[model samples]
Structure formats: C-alpha cells, structure tokens
Target: MSSTPPPLPPHALDRLRAAVRLREAGDAESARSELLALSGTYPRDPGLAYQTAWAHDVLGREAAAVPFYETALAGADALGAEDRHGVYLGLGSTYRVLGRYAEAVATLEAGLAAHPGDGALTVFLAMARHNTGAHHEAMSALLTLLADTSGDPGVRAFRKAIAFYAEDLDRVETGD
Candidate 1:
C-alpha cells in the first residue's frame, strides 16, 4: 500500500485574502466573521488571529482584541521579522484604543528600538505620547521622524497633526 499526502484545502488561501480585503475595506463585522471562520479551520494561523484582533479593534471592542493581539505577537515572534513588526504595530494600536497609553508607548518604543528609524513605529509612539498628554514630547518625536527623508508619508501627515497639538500645548503652557 502506498501512502498518499493530503491535498491542500481548496480556496482556503483565497478566503483568507477575502477576509483581509474586508478588513481593509473597514467592514469589521464581515472581516471578523470571515477571519474567525478561518481561525476555526486553522487554529495556528497567526495572520487570521491578527486580522480578527484588528476587526475587534475597529469595532471598538478593545477588550476582546487584546488577547488575540498578544497571540499574534507571540506567533509572529517565532516566525519572521516582517510578521513580528506587524504584530507589534497591531498590539500598540490596540493598547492605544484601550486607553493603555503607557503600554502603547512602551510597546511602540520597543519596536522602534528593535527596528531603528522605523517611521510607522515612530508615528505610533507619537500618538501614544499624545494620548497620554505628553504633547511636547510627542511633537519632538514627530519632528525628528519627519526630518528623516525615509519617513513614511502617513507618518509625515501625522507629524503635521502632532505639530498642531504641540502648538495648542504651547499656547496653554504660555497662558496665552
């Protein structure tokens, strides 16, 4: 008797892609439904777990998002650098939503320290600082990031927002 290997599941990858599409389209409900289904099929699929966590975050269910984000981070840690960066970003964003500003700042800062000069993590750290009322510090970080030629466009735009916040902080600080 010859042993035969099992064939890959048809359309599984496609379904995962569709779930990611739904996530990008801002359809958190649909994204969660599809990603949850995918997770059920592949319990060890970190991407699906990450996306599901993101969907929960988009739906304002921050509490529900934390554990999934943690799982994704753990899985990504052992997988690949890019995947690990993504999970760190997702976890930082989720912590920000949960009003866990300190954790968000720490997490994003750790990611930036690991991947130095990473504009995305810089932006996230700035946001975390801003959320925690560290406006001056946030603005300083944003300015540093914006001055870097390699900084991301999205982060540059966020720098502008932080500048505005910084201006407001200045006014308040000066009693103007």
Candidate 2:
C-alpha cells in the first residue's frame, strides 16, 4: 500500500473554507457547529481541529477550544504552513484569556522554539507575561525580540520598542 493518502474531497475542503469564512464574519457559533459536524470524517485533519477551536476562541469560549487546540497540535502535519504556527498562537492566547497564564507562557515559548523568530510568538509571549503580572519580564522579552528582529533586513523593530516605552512612560506619569 502507498504511504501517501489521497487528496481531501473538494466538497469537504469547500465546507472547511465556508466555515472559516463564517468565523471571520463573526458567526462563530455556526462555524463551530459546521466543523464539529465534520470531526469524525476528518479526524486527523489539523485544519478542522484548528478551525473548530478558532471559532470557540473567537466566541470567547476558551475552555471549549482548549482540547481542540491540543488535538490539532498533536497531529499538526496535516496543517498548512501558516496554520502550523497559528494554532500554537491561538492555543496560547486562549490559555491567557482563561487566566492560565503559565500554560500560555509555556505554549508560546514552545511555539517560538519550534518557529524561531516568529513575531506573533513574541507578541503573545509578552501578553502572557503581562497577564501573569510579570511586567518587567514582558518588557525584557519584547526587548530581546526587538533586538533579534531589528537585525533582519527591512524589518522595523525600533518603532515597536518606542511604542512600548512610550506606553510605560504614560502609565508611570499617570501613576497607574
């Protein structure tokens, strides 16, 4: 038997695409239901798992999305390039929203390790840190990100650094 699997049916792909569009349009409940209906057929399709979780997350239902995100990560090979890392981001951010800041930190850190220099990971990591009341640590992490990204050609990092610093200055000035 061949090791390769056949391509997904066009109809199934279309359904997935439609679900994504529904989620983007803020009809996340419909999107989640649509994808949940397809889970048994595409058990290993990471995109399905990710999209299902995304709808839940977008609807502010983080707890429901957590397992789906974990499932998607457990079998991520079926995902596209952007989705492979995007799922990690979604999972980490969900954890943060749920007040599970430590899991958020670890998840985002793992994402950074897997996809080094990803700006999304850096930003989410900073957010997770801040949520955990580690403001200094968050700033340190962002500064490291700024240093790493600024060295790359044509990528602006100093602007972000300035923005963060400016926010801090304003907060301190207002005694917040």
Candidate 3:
C-alpha cells in the first residue's frame, strides 16, 4: 500500500481554490462559509482545516479558529511545509491575541525549532515573549532580527553593535 495520502478530488480542489480566491478578494465571510461547508465533506483534510482556520482568523474569530488550526497541525504529515509553517504562526499568533501567552510561546518556540531563522516566526515569538513578561528575551529577539534583516544603511553599519547589545541589553562598559 502506498504511504502517501490520496490526492484531493478535483472538485474538492477546485472548491478549495475558489474559497481561497474569495478570501483574497476581501470576502472573508464567503470564504469562511465555503471552507466550513467543504470541511464537513472533507473532515480529515489537513489543508481544508488550515484554510478554515485562516478564514476564521481573517474574520476576527480567533477562538473559533483554534480547533481547526490544531486539527491541521495534528495532521502535519499530510500538509506541505508552507502550510505547516502557517499553522504554527497562525495558532501561535491567535493564542497571543487571545491572552494565551504561554501557549503562544510554546507554539512559536516549537515552530522556531522546526523552521529556524524564519523572520516572521521570530517576530511573532518576540511578541509572545513580551506578552509573557519575558521582556529581556523579547527585546533581544527583536534586536537580533533587526540587526540581521534590516535594510537601512545606518542599521547595517551598526549591525555588530546591535547584535552585541542584543546579547546583554543592560550591560555597562567602563574604560579602565
């Protein structure tokens, strides 16, 4: 028996694409409706679950999105890398906005462990840390990300200094 999951039926794929298009066209409500309907028919589809969660998120329904995101992530082996990454970010960010800071930190940390050096994930992780009162870690993460990714010439010039300070923001240096 083939270990690979069977490909989605053509009609299902078309419906999924149409739902995504609705979302992109600024009709998130319609998208959510379509995705929810499709999810009823394709209850085990990881991709569908992910899209349903995204639609809920775009509609400012973070709590409603959590179970769908969890379902998608639980079936991670069936999802593409990009979808997996989105699940982690979406779930983590949703948790943060919902005041579930510890869950956000755990989710984002797990994502970073799996997809290291991702700027978006790092940024969200920093936000989660800040919410959890890990101010030092949050600032350090933001500073490091800024130093590594900022395009401003001035920032580039001071990258080394920023990195050094990121390691120890409260450091005091005295000339002897």
Ranking by TM-score: 3, 2, 1
> What is the per-residue lDDT of model 1 for residues 10-100, given as tens digits with 9 covering 90 to 100?
6876887788898788787998888787777766556666777888888888888788777676566453678678778889977997899
Q: Please state the error at residue 106 of candidate 3 in Å.
A: 0.8
Q: Which 10-residue window of candidate 3 scores lowest in summed lDDT?
A: 1-10
Q: State every prediction's TM-score relative to the real structure.
A: 0.67, 0.73, 0.93
The lDDT of model 1 is: 0.76
Supply candidate 3's per-residue lDDT for 69.
91
Provide the lDDT at 87 for model 3. 95
* 1-176 per-residue lDDT for model 3 (tens digits): 65444667999999999999999999999999999999888776789999999999999999999999988878777888999999999999999999999999999998998899999999999999999899999999999999999999999999999999999999998979
- Measured with C-alpha atoms, the lDDT of residue 42 in candidate 1 is 67
Task: Report model 2's TM-score to 2 decimal places.
Answer: 0.73
On the 0 to 100 scale, the lDDT of residue 155 in model 2 is 42
lDDT of each: 0.76, 0.81, 0.93
Candidate 2: regions farther than 4 A off: 1-8, 146-176
lDDT preference between candidates 2 and 3, better one: 3
Pairs with backbone N, CA or C atoms under 3 Å apart (clashes), candidate 2: none
RMSD of each: 7.8, 6.8, 2.0
